[model samples]
Target chain A: MKKMNNRSDVAVKYLLISKDGNALMEIGEKSAGIEKQIKIDGYDIETIVGFPNIEKKEQIVDGIAKIIELLKNGEKIFNDDVLIEYVDMIINEKSIDEILYFTLKHIISSNLAEKTAFFILNDKLLKLRGVVYLKRDNEDIIFENRAIKSCQIDLSNRGKIADAMFFDKVVTVNYSELPGKNIERYFDKNTIIIPVYNIKGVVGVVLLEDDGTKAKDDASLRLVSRLVSLGINYSSITKQLKLSKEDVAYFKESIEVSSTLTHMGKITASVAHEIKNPLVSIGGFAKRLERYVSDERGLSYLKIIQSETTRLEQIVNDILTYSKIFNIKREKVSLYSLLMDLEEFFKDELMIKRIMVKINCPEDLIAYIDPRKFKQIFVNLIKNSIQSIENDGEITIDVERVKNGINIIIRDTGDGFPIEIIQRPFEPFVTTKEAGTGLGLSICHKIVSAHQGQIWLDNYDDGAMVKIFIPSEGEV
Target chain B: MKVKKILIVDDEPNVARLYEDYLKDYGFEVKSINNPHEATNEFYMFQPDLVLLDVNMPDKDGLTVLRELKKVSPNVPVYLLTAHDEYKRNFNALYAEEYILKSRDPKIIVNLIEKIKE
Candidate 1:
């Protein structure tokens, strides 16, 4: 057996003996005499292998021919049908992680590497999640190492690797010349890192390390890049599936609630009709009785009937007012104008109840809202407050602009809502008052949500406060 | 002027009778129908100068009847009777002469009818 001295010299000698043997001989003229001297020094002639002087030339030629034949057979075997069958096996696998594990194992086996790992990118922290080794005996492949540090290297200056991966592409660190960071904490001693990217963005990385020099070859890097891209595409498809499931759930809930509202609307309309006809008859008869009746008892009874009929009318009005849903007609409305209109409409009621109403809104303060809907919202709030307070209680309406939005607060000297009612005051059929329809605050909530605003009730020590926050027009 | 004969169409007999008696006191010859199905024939036969139509009926909705009345006599003024205030906007869209809330005192309706007669 002949021993080879110095691997580099062996590689050079093999290259010189190849197709460019004559050119290499001219370059080796200076060392020609040294080769002659080595022959005289009793070096074994059979051990002295050169690129051009091959002892087993015929065997090498035969091996190459066989490899070519095998390649052609492999191509025929993987014709479209076979290729599709292989792809279906990978795609139908229960988990993508299992497919990735097998793929990493295959790469390490084919490349004859010491170790290989696949790290999936964590979107939340922009970091690696797990490491899958190919043949290495490291059982803790998926363990998170917090001590690992990363250093960003600018490859733009290096022309060879400049456009290899785009600017956003992650490059693997050469462990031998690792940059000034705790890079070794992430990978083995001799590893090559390659980024994984899908159409959307970079999703993961692949690391290959080995004792052999072939691990850093360009061909190996290119093969690993293609596999990473396939893995990233699979991950993105999974993410889209999750989002579609959530959307389906939300759509079902919306359909259920809308149907409930439609049924309620129909029932209310019919009941209102039944109640009104008899009410009109009673009012008409009461009016005629008042004209003919002279006794105090008879006159008082007629007055009672008239008052009761009026109360029933108010109840019907409230029901109708709360059930209607209107689209927003956004327009710039002055707070001063709204307050003035409300004050005029409620003036008589205020006088009769002896409630003192005060407005503290700014004259120039403006907000964009559906005027009709907002009018009803504010009126309901104010009326509820007035009804809660005792006779002579004070009510104040104030509007102010703050932090890119407008806040309208209505405060009244009334006993605050009970603790139980306060928690879910905006829910339908939740009322504190004897004559409450329980839909007042629910309607208010729906209106505020439609306007892209918020309405909340605050319980103060002395009174109750209702505050409305509406985002300013043109302001997100 | 034949007192500008008025027709009252409602599903409730008592409601129909109330309007008929009240409008008669105001010197108007009023015809009334409690069944909405019979409204189309009676409406044309009466040749009413104005019609008071109730919005909620068992056989047919008031809006359908309103459309039929408009086809029969587009020029004749029709007033819709809605018990609920929520229907006010919908009533406005019907292009009726006016909307009469049923919850209001019958005296208001009598006064409104007299004003419409003018």
Candidate 2:
């Protein structure tokens, strides 16, 4: 593979890998010169960590001198031989961030450079968020600052730093010392700025102080970039996985809370049933006493007792109904007979209001239903229709046979249901009337549901149109 | 004509007495037993034509008592009464002639039992 040119204008030769971490081709960067294929067999990376440079044929004498000195102690040792073992040791150490820190530290220490700063892009803002700077003072290697206060390197061609990053290639901007160039201001006189690319695009820049020698330290520069890229990718993935794990925990907690709410609902239903028993006993005894009380004052007081107890009874019934433990007795009934009886039952009110009642049903339409419960469904619906008419309104009841069931439609020539509550009319305590219990539709809905049937309001502009479907067969 | 006899078994003493009072007023010989264990004994002694059994009770529930009572007198009619609709609504109440909730007005219950007598 062709290695990045150490003689590039940038402080370091940057080889851009794809931002997604796939291809090693830098996006916009042109290596200052044609790439030279790496002579891997000539220079082993391990050699620089311990022994003198042996890749330079001119340094053969120095390499030999180092070997002879080790041999004088009855050993022939070479750093190149230990390259595999040392790389494994450095990787085995966990805390990859620290590994990258020390890996870069080791590279700078070996190359004998004065300063280095690693800059990684914040993809969201398209700016450098991290500036990992290190310094070497005599024998002490100090990590002076990893945070940059004003580290906004624009990903544009405004300066050399922006140009190298935006172009997705490394450019070594040469200067005797730190220049006014945006990225150059952070480095020493001789700096090498390299581009670090993730799999898909250029992500950051890595700048190292060049030793200012006639011949640059090309061997070590080539390897440092590889180690630094690997470290950055590892840190990004770990952070994302941690955030995802927290999201999963929050999801599980909501499920637990909802389950608890369901349990509480069951308990409340049973408690309401118990309360109804005493309420019944209280109301029953009060009514039985009304017959004995003959005075006007006593009778008027008894009337209050009678009305309030009935209202309280209805609320208990609603709670029990929601709990869903009620039973029904099924019997075959003709739909025509039920409607005729309902008409007769409401004859007085219809005559007084001068409202016409129309029934459209076949004589033989019959189904097995709990007569009382089925009657309640129609009564609740018809009563609401009657109340809606301001004057001589008409109610039309239509029944037709449909698939596996009967469809009953009650259309009234009155003001249609208010648009605000039309969508969910069956919800408990939803009513337009001031004196309504607000559970009429909910009760009707419950009765239909218990019969394993569907009931809904058919849209109409002039009047309210209700549609009901009950299976002809008994589910029991 | 011989007057019909009715036996009532309930866990609550007040409720049992309440039924006894209403049944006596309906022109029937009425007996109330609060304990399920004593219910069988009362059944044999009173030899009631009708049995009004509470669905839930101490020691033995109404279902258990019904099974025991039926084993002794399989032909007699037994009605189940419950404080709530849940027990009466359950299909476990299949053996009962009728299951009624105690939450209703007492006069309705009296009228229902009178019809069962005929």
Candidate 3:
């Protein structure tokens, strides 16, 4: 509470600070008595409005980091309500990984260093998840090896980096000052390692190269320090309050899902291998036998066997490929050109089925995404529409530009999705065709999701409809 | 112009035969060998402008053979043919001229080879 005295009515303290983080709770208990009376130079005042200090520091460095992040992007955040919303959005999330991802993005874009490596401690697993970001050709690239790999570190590690990680303290060292030869490999000549900690223990560490120039100023250092500290505290506090049990349950559920997917992929790959081997013979011999068939009846029958084998091979291949890692290679792909290419490729099939195709998109519609994955999404949706349609059916594709992404609607003149599983056709092995392996939509779902897009089955009286929305630059 | 020669190394006879047949139809001289261990020997004997090396082999993994083949004929362009699609395939195919999925049509391989030859 503010100490109002018979001194001056001219000054006021807007944000009040206390020992604990729960200043709002404290204000709730004291606001009743303070609001009733106020004495300033023997003059009565009308109001003593106060907001709680949500941070403990010599100065309020709490929201400054967020303000810096916002300002760096040229965003003007002036309204206090919007500021609180931003603060709540920043501090409320339970996932430290999400926060770190954004922080790393901001740091990289800030161009503060040549290389940065982020490590988050897994208290349950006793290991460090290493994330490395390198600035290459003016683009931030996550070095693949260090991005996917985890490192085991303890206090026994000799270098200054190990000191920072193990001791839960920040350290800076030069190339020559690095302790041992083995430890020398992990770091550059000059590095600053900072450890992030909470009430429980060490939570994360970030390594930044000194670059021999660009020495960090005091304000920036304090901001980084406080941001790290806040991130660690918020994550742990949220977990303690609401997520401790659910985290374990969610982990168990994901393990079950991934393990099941792995088992299915393994079996599918093996089966694809076994079938692919003999399929080569069957397909090769059928094409070879085409020369021997003279009569029209014999030739047509041989063609059926030939095409069937090819189709079967395709199904097996699709299943195998679907089960594998969908590595995304993003680029700026023109949707118009992609559609033209797809139209050309499918021309023969469309002719065979006697189907009419129409593309309702801008002449230069473009999106930043992996073209292959994008193609996969549209192709699967097209195929899903195709299978539902009979001969002479029509397929129309419409594209619309949304706030941050593009929305595409593919509608077909076939029976709409079955009423029961219409919502879950994206699930693996959910198909209407007798020959379908059911991985088509699932693969499409995976590819779309990897591109940070959403795919869903839409209902229309005319036929089956599938809608897709992909971000302009694959940003989520 | 001398006809472009192609070397196909695969464990599966039908696959090798399929590639051999398709490339020959495209008017390129082609040889099919099953054992990967014989790739280096075949490379010297065939002296082909291009080599189609299959990743899954019995005697030696395709990458090892690729290393040995590279040591012998450093400039002979090699195209990786693999049914497996894993990123670990990244290192194996890093040095190759191109990596083609075997599950794709044999025409794609022929097209890539002809394009490279041109």
Candidate 4:
């Protein structure tokens, strides 16, 4: 009898016990120079001498026992018919994680391989999607390792797994010849890499680290690959179906919102038109009576009436504007000249606040826009900045041309929006000022959206900041 | 320069009266018509140097009445007035002298008339 001193001796065979399972009858051994031979030949030995059985002393024992019993009855563990039935039962009812967990546990408990790992292939990138290993403490099976979950196998370099994926066939390489650090980290000697295929050809690969006893039959390994490929395909199809459903739901919602806006627009225009007639009457009479009034208090009352009516008229006009449909007229206009025009228009307001305006934009930077409509966005934002600043502050308009669009950032050196209003600044009727109609930002949002653009607000550096992105191509 | 007679046409009687009072105090001979159907008849009778025509009216479309007024007095400067600027785009092609938003102070009409380059 050999001394059982060599590492390969203990690795390939185990202690054979009597039927009573109380004593070891003999130490099993195999030919020493069989390294070059396929490990599949070892499966011919029917006795459980060299195989490791489930030793977990917990409720998990029943699951392991059932898998071992099925194998003992001469049923091939990788049989596609049996696996499809089992996979079908749990596939739809369980999450991908749970499915992977059950499949991995079945693989290990049936003694198909000592340890296994599943990799999801995306083109040349192999992501370590899931892994299963036996715990050394109680020999309980485990599914995922958080530390190794993000590990990726790049197929650019030559390795057994990459070779199997690229060649679309099975690859067997010794642990030392694994070709990459990540491959060497997860696998042991005599590791087999089998490519999993779908209708689209090879989609993934499985790494089986066998204990030198199981048959490495090509037919059985291919079947295992087919089974796993089915699971991957099912997961992907279900994910796409879920996304399609969500897209349909979103489409329905947008249609309903657009219809509601159209209805609201009609009502607002009619109401604004009706309110304007009364406003003209009240405002016109107030001015007429001011000339005939004598007392100082009477004069002040008349002034209030006139000013409040003007304010009411302004509110009505804003409502009409907000609900108005935008017929975008696209034009190629220089943004610099537009800002300069606004600065000139608001010269008096800017001067009164002692505000310094600095615009950082290319004089030649042109954007496709409706000049009249685009001007309204800047006018509202700049005016807000002016009103926010109490006295003597800087307002900066920084513009950059992006690949698909233009980016504009407006920053004001003033106290930012109040916290409550900042969260929903673009919503109608949200304002911090007492006299504000609160439709300013909403109108800006509407116009920017009409131009296939986006707008958002933030607070930083002791001021309020507004960022806007307008796509270069207008949706005319 | 005589009084630079101004004709005001609007559907609202009170609004028309208000403008008549303000423009009369500003030393302009102002006559207002509350009905659009009566506008062209008044324009011929009043023989005003300028016209302040409201865009929206109950009896008829102000743009149609504008065409009638232009036919008779093509040389006269007619300003389109409205509570909203929706009609601004149409005013230019119709050859109106200016577009006045009714939201403005009525005194603006006086100021615009005072600056007439007749």
CAPRI level of candidate 4:
incorrect
Weakest ten-residue segment in model 1 chain A by summed lDDT: A37-46
Please, what is the TM-score per model?
A: 0.50, 0.43, 0.47, 0.49
Q: Enumerate residue pairs that collide in model 3.
A: A6-A41
What DockQ does every candidate get?
0.09, 0.04, 0.06, 0.13
Compared with the true structure, what per-residue lDDT tens digits does model 3 show for residues A150-225?
Answer: 3434322235554455444567777456443333445556877777654333566676677776656534543454
Worst lDDT 10-window in candidate 4 chain A: A37-46
Pairs that clash in candidate 1: A17-A51, A17-A52
Better of 2 and 4 by lDDT: 4
Give lDDT: candidate 1, residue A49: 28
Question: What residue runs in model 3 are displaced by over 4 Å at the alpha carbon?
Answer: A1-258, A292-298, A329-368, A391-398, A401-406, A419-423, A470-476, B1-8, B17-33, B38-53, B69-118
lDDT of 4 at A8: 22
lDDT of each: 0.61, 0.63, 0.64, 0.68
Instruction: Identify the CAPRI category of the predicted complex in candidate 1.
Output: incorrect
Docking tier of model 2: it is incorrect
Residue-level lDDT of model 2, residues A372-461, one tens digit each, is 888888888888888888779899999888878888999998888877459677876677776576778888888888888888885586
Which candidate achieves the best DockQ against the true structure? Answer: 4
